[model samples]
Target: MTEASKYGITLEKLRSRAAKGDLTQREIRAYFEPDERRGEAFAPAFKLTEFVDKQGKRPSARTVTELYFGAEMGVVSGPRARLRPRSRGRGITTTASAARMKVLAEGDSWFRLPNLSWPVSYPDDLVDVLRQTYEIPGVAMWGAEIGHMVTVQKNNYLVPLRSGLYRHFMFSGGGNDVLASVQTHVKRFGAAGTNPSSAESYLKASFDGALATVIGHYRTLAGHVRSVSNPKPTLYVHGYAHARPLPGGPYIGAKLEALGFDANSSLARKIVAAMVDRFNVKLKAFAAAENAAHPTYKVVYVNLRPAFTSAADWNTDEIHPSDAGAAKAAARMGDNIAANVPVA
Candidate 1:
């Protein structure tokens, strides 16, 4: 017979002897050790440690019960009630699925999950979708004591749970000074000569300058992560664009309408597309450099949808999301991380 088959018989005999107190825990541990490795190994000593440890050991009754009947003894005793069958739930939420797929596609599994610190304004539909689909666990960082401690100078103050652990990082500002400040980094290149559209050209030039500034900000953040001991992968989730025009300004779509353009104009689409594309390019460069420096650590970019609909959704006049909005965002973010990253 094979060694496994022979070992099965030995295990059966050991259990039989153990049931009658003929075999001590030490002996039980010793039998599992290889013949040449037995006695000298420390498993036997540790087995006895379990009996005296304050943490308490798995019940010895379990072993005795199994030895006598070859079945677990802790089966539920009460009458089992029939659970109502669930309807075929809606397919996983689009945002949740997309976020998960993005992480997996980037091929990084290590994640630093953070908790939401603020309330969001949207209906809880998205929150429910995230919870049901991802089965994410809440981490201790979500508590108010820890979540609000960080001061984000120009950015929204979301809880930074993984700051100590993450090597790669991304940050998203919710349509306020944070996004505006980041945008100021892009390099501005004006049109060659003045024309009727020279004013428009100058605006374009300014935006380019802002883009460069944002890139520098990202580089600085990445360096911070690398400075940590044994830094792991990190990615900052970022907002696409402001949902509103500016301080004391109309809503994004409304602004377009006021300018005699269709609220759903192609120009708006183009602007968003350009913003996304520029962000992706910068992200690729960041990822490439980080991967080269630390082959084991991977960098990634995560994009979140703009959630602003009114002034009430923001925490202050400047741009941070309300607590309710933050919670919804957190749930979406947690679900994404759980689906792609290993826990436990």
Candidate 2:
């Protein structure tokens, strides 16, 4: 029988469990435990916690996973990581100190997707990689539509920005923001938006306008967090690579040439792809500006555009990457993330 048939951990199965409640530690632990006898593969990455710690070592996954359950589930007590949501002026905030420590992953559907088979996407690999590398017991990742994020930190979520807790913050944005607006801007800007640079500028301007409120809210949110954090925090952002003009249905990139956005020939793909690339260009600029302006703390914009370029082999859909593609991305950036993040 297949792993899905044997293990009962299919994508939708996990998603349903996650949606309804926290995954049982026993269940999650079983996922890692060697079961070759039961015809399972051994993953050192999943079970790596027992042996290693990078700089100074941190808590075992056994400890952190205890706290990742549903709100007030109270599966464990006196844990180092905060598990319950408490009173805060605005978005959700976990109690300070006296709680198990954890690293956090935050962003959109791309970050939170729970696919089991044909698993790809950096988030897919990084989830397990994190358990091994950081030695943290748990992580909290959140994501929604761009408008949702801009509206209220993706719906009133300030996250576990506790003082001296949380090791790293990684997320994806601006993709959803630019996706729907692509046709409109291309139509308005006409052929000028076709060039990568021009496409970048147009997309950037649109986000700057559409996302100003979101940006301001994050500033305020970060300010609140910075005040609590001793060294502030470092954040990672990425730009998306371009997708082909194939149909992802009418909602996205289907029939762009017919729509008069693409310039015919490969230029069509290049122009649209360049528009996505613009987000990265803008991300770099945004990070640099923020770092320059701030006396301390930093924001890092990771560039994945080059890696994914002409990488037809790695993509499953026009936009979402295939498993191999996601793995390639995870490999490329894993060390960088490991090196930069604070160890628990």
Candidate 3:
């Protein structure tokens, strides 16, 4: 019987229990232990905690199963490493304390402080990012993509940008909406016949307008990430933008071309550059804030080859990435950030 079938209950049913707070720790353990004769590995139980922690809250059984499968597929890590007390008694150790001590225990192997709190999406991506870019030792060497949701302001209707060193602020297809909203607000208030001398107020209003949109989106994203119990500090964002255009249209278009489309166009290149410029600015701001807020957290930006460059990287549409493409992007991005972030 399949893993799902072996449980005698559907994965969704398990998730429903988790969502409804019906799945207790004992029940969760039993859910993973399919065989009655041989004891099931504790790894599943451990994974449940990791899933809950990484998601910032308890996850549905289905979500846990998907994460497990994804981890097995090298898509990401099933769970963040659990903090355990040293053989020597150092008083009672809570999970949170253990994690902090573990970083310290790992010593140079781990990056300390705010940097440690950065969200990790794909465990394999984390491994790749760390291995290829930064050389933090003692990391379990897993890769995964951070799961995030997008939000906009209720009044201003702004979406957060996704491309940045901080995964929280960068959003996919989210920046465009934010920029448009800001522009609209600027025009609307400008036409109100407010004196140009109120430039400071106007600017503040515009910034507030943008900030409201960003904050609202971030709050929603943060809440969702938290709901998953993801341990990393939630960094809200939208999507990625690029600096250059490939022979096709933009980098995304070039990626499509790589996927087998005739996307070569002048507009594609312009769009790519524009997107890149915007992304860079957003990244810089995010990095600066992170650096200020958490001195130890490292933030870095990487320029990767367009996905369209290789058929292996193309998703169904050629524009988006397949699982492999997402993996590669995670790795490259992680590596870049790791390398650039100053070690605390």
The C-alpha RMSD of each candidate to the native structure, in angstroms, is 21.4, 13.6, 15.5
lDDT of 2 by residue, 1-344 (tens): 75434445543344344445555544444333322232211111122222122234343443232222331122112121223212111221234322433555555434433322111123243333333233232322222444455445532333455535655666566555655456655544463544545644434355556545444444554454345465466676666566565544332445464565543335556656766755566667766777788757666677765656454533444555554455455555555576785566
Better of 2 and 3 by lDDT: 2
Model 3 regions more than 4 Å off? 1-13, 16-264, 289-298, 305-313, 322-331, 337-344
For model 1, the run of ten residues with the poorest summed lDDT: 104-113
Give the Cα error of residue 324 in candidate 2, in Å. Answer: 2.0
TM-score of 2: 0.58
lDDT of 3 by residue, 75-193 (tens): 11113322211111223223333242111001000111111111212112222222222222232211111222242221111111121112222222233332223233222233323
Residue 40 of candidate 2: its Cα lDDT? Answer: 14
Q: Which candidate has the highest TM-score of all?
A: 2
TM per candidate: 0.37, 0.58, 0.33
Runs of candidate 1 with Cα error greater than 4 angstroms are: 1-170, 174-203, 230-233, 239-264, 303-336, 339-344
Model 2 / residue 313 / CA error / Å: 5.3
Model 3 reaches what TM-score against the true structure? Answer: 0.33
Q: Write the per-residue lDDT of candidate 1 for residues 169-219, one digit (tens) a residue.
A: 334422222223322422222222223233232234555555565566556
Instruction: Give the CA lDDT, 0 to 100, for residue 32 in model 1.
Output: 30
